[model samples]
Target: MPISTYQVKSFAFVVREGSISGAARRLGVSQSAVSQHISNLEATMGAQVLIRGRDGVALTPVGQDLFQLADEYASLDQRIEERLRGHAALDRGHLTIIANAPQPALSLIARYADGYPNVSIDFTLFDWSSAMQRLQERRVDIAVITEPAASRELYIRPITQSRYVCYARRDDDFAQRPVVHLRDVADRTLILPEPGSLTQRVVSKALADHGVVPRRLVTMTSFPVMKEAILEGVGVGLFLSASSVSERSLCEVAVPELDQVFTTCAVVPKHKLGLRVIKSFLDVLADSRA
Candidate 1:
């Protein structure tokens, strides 16, 4: 028996979309049809290619090897189809983008949209960990992340560099200070993002290293919420600089111990770089740097 291209493409879409239903929607087929294609693929290969879980499908070792080639084939097929369609190549497409912070990602997205107005974009903000997870899972087209881990599978373009800062109400005592050390916030309430977030990991390490413990530690869902909590007298909030909206009632105080600068980068899978949509967005990024 020979392997079918439809089966491979279906498997690729399943991995790309992270769910059977999503692949079905992308393929304009029924869920049962997608599952049948996957089952057929496994039978032909004599191995299980996917591990279906409640969250989504994960690639087995064999599936991982197959996906790399299938993804490239899919990209090539799309390119060929676009070429045959003439000027419609760059006129339409969809991109899924994830980011940890707003600045560079939102700005870059705006610029890309101007050049490719017909292209639809789905942009979402996530904490550092979640953003990177989505990128690793091959679920998103692009990721703008802070200090993204190096991987041969990904191509990273440095966007900007920034350090962490503490946010406090204008009337708070720390707000009037030019700079505060890690130990300075020890006796005050501390507001931070929830666990599993980069902010929490970095702050936690810093606190442990310096043996600084806050009087009360509070966790918020996001940077914007942390800012609001600060205004409502919840506690001092810590996060990367320029990550949230600036407010007249809030003051950004520099923290010397947490002054390590982190680079933000736009990352895409190496194999995805050849895709027209991905390549176009990178062109926008390149133009911005020039």
Candidate 2:
């Protein structure tokens, strides 16, 4: 027998979440039920889909192949639902956005909702890793991410550039420093997003290139949290450079010879542009400020 769509969904969620418990929470199902579905899927496919351990679950090579298939299956399912709706329903519709919370993407979503108030919109925020999971699962239409999308499998496109700027408290003497080096911030505490976050990863690499890693690191989920901490004298750190005064109060310090550039992206399946709604959002994104 062929594996069912639900089983595929269960499998993909399990793989992305890295544990049966996490998958169950996402799917709104019980852990045993998720495991049973995966078991049936693996049996029907004649492959050991998942390797279970104390660390959690990981997909076998064969399971990875199915993961791609599962993504396609989800895309098709969504397209079918959209197509089945009437003309009027099509004209006024709902769009689900999944991306890093508190970024300009949220601003895009807010503007879209304001313009099309009658058309319902659901915005889902996820950290970089979970956003990838949502995009692959077709749970979201597009992801506005800070991470570069280059896997080819995920269809990464760079819509625009968002630079990384160093900022500190207004009265902090560090801001007065002429040229900031990783050496300067070496012993200072740093406010940053989690390791899985794209911005943090890029900064981490930049630090590694300079042979400097801070001993004190604070990890949070969003920029606002990190920014708040920075302003509160918790730590001095770098964040995405934007034109907003509220987001940028301190000065943009020049780091000592490193690639501090970040690209804000609209990530989706290659064929996602087939829909007018998806394409329209992308167009809006391109026209908007950096």
Candidate 3:
């Protein structure tokens, strides 16, 4: 019998994740089922593909060869399925998108949800590093990030651009200023995103360059929490201009010294661009601004 796509997928997941259990968890299948798929694939191929040891599963020489074939096969499967869906005029599919910045993806997702009610989307909020790593590993179909470094391995399309802005309470002494300098807030407590976030890195570097440090520094993971703290007079917050939209109570101050502007992009593995769903979404994104 021909090896099923499920069997190949299980094998690929095992190779990608490095364990039967990891593959099972990723595929949402039982460990026994994953093992059975591997056993069947090995039998059909008449070669050992995986060696299970204390560390994890390692691909044999033959398995390494098969692994490459499996990646191509998986990519082909996605293309075929997308074509089939197109021919059937079925708008139903699952898209997994991991992003750090919520801008354009959130807007695009809203449009997609309304247009293709049958399609489901899995959007995960991840740090910048995890967002890039997952896209490189092909774990997520799409990634949205700010000012990502250039990479030939992936295809990146810019969605929008924004500049860094300072958020402070309306009644604060510096709130009415046209431009707020780092020195103005040097003595005040600062609220920012956690350490690994791109926004925090930009703000920190700008502060360090100016030799300024806040009286108190607070890092929070949730954007709403950071906004609430700023509104409640906890501390000043640095955010992208897009994040400050519709926020009437807080004052938005531009800092010319931190002249860095952020560009948000949608990144995908170049190999997976042939999928119709991905292509359609990219089209929507492109047309969105027009």
**Number of the top candidate by TM-score?**
1
What tens-digit string does per-residue lDDT give for candidate 3 at 1-290?
79988999899878766689977976779999999999999999899999999999877999877776686677778688667666344366667787775666788888877777776787877767767766755667778888776788689999888888888889987688899888877898988888778878888888998999899999987456788898898888888877534677888889888777688898987877887777877877887867
Query: Lowest summed lDDT over 10 consecutive residues: which window, candidate 2?
Result: 243-252
Model 2 lDDT tens row, 1-290: 87787798788667656689977976679999999999998888888989999999767889877777775665566466567773332466556676664666777876666655665566666678878866765556678877644655566667557666666876777878875777778888977777777768778887888888787988887776777787788888766666224534555566655445667787876756666567667666766654
Task: Quote the lDDT for 69 in model 1.
Answer: 88
Task: Please give the distance, in angstroms, between residue 64's alpha carbon in candidate 2 and its true position after superposition.
Answer: 7.8
lDDT value, residue 61 of candidate 2: 89
What do the candidate models score in CA lDDT, each in turn? Answer: 0.87, 0.71, 0.80
Model 3 segments more than 4 A misplaced: 1-4, 13-32, 38-72, 85-88
Off by over 4 Å in 2: 1-74, 77-92, 177-179, 213-215, 243-245, 248-251
Q: What lDDT score goes with residue 116 in model 3?
A: 71
Cα distance off (Å), candidate 2, residue 280: 2.7
> Could you tell me the TM-score of candidate 2?
0.67
> Cα deviation in Å at residue 248, candidate 1?
3.7
Pairs of residues at least 3 apart in sequence or in different chains that clash in candidate 1: none
Cα deviation at 288, candidate 1, in Å, is 3.2
Model 1: runs farther than 4 Å from truth?
A: 87-89
Highest-scoring model, lDDT: 1
Candidate 1 lDDT score at position 83: 71
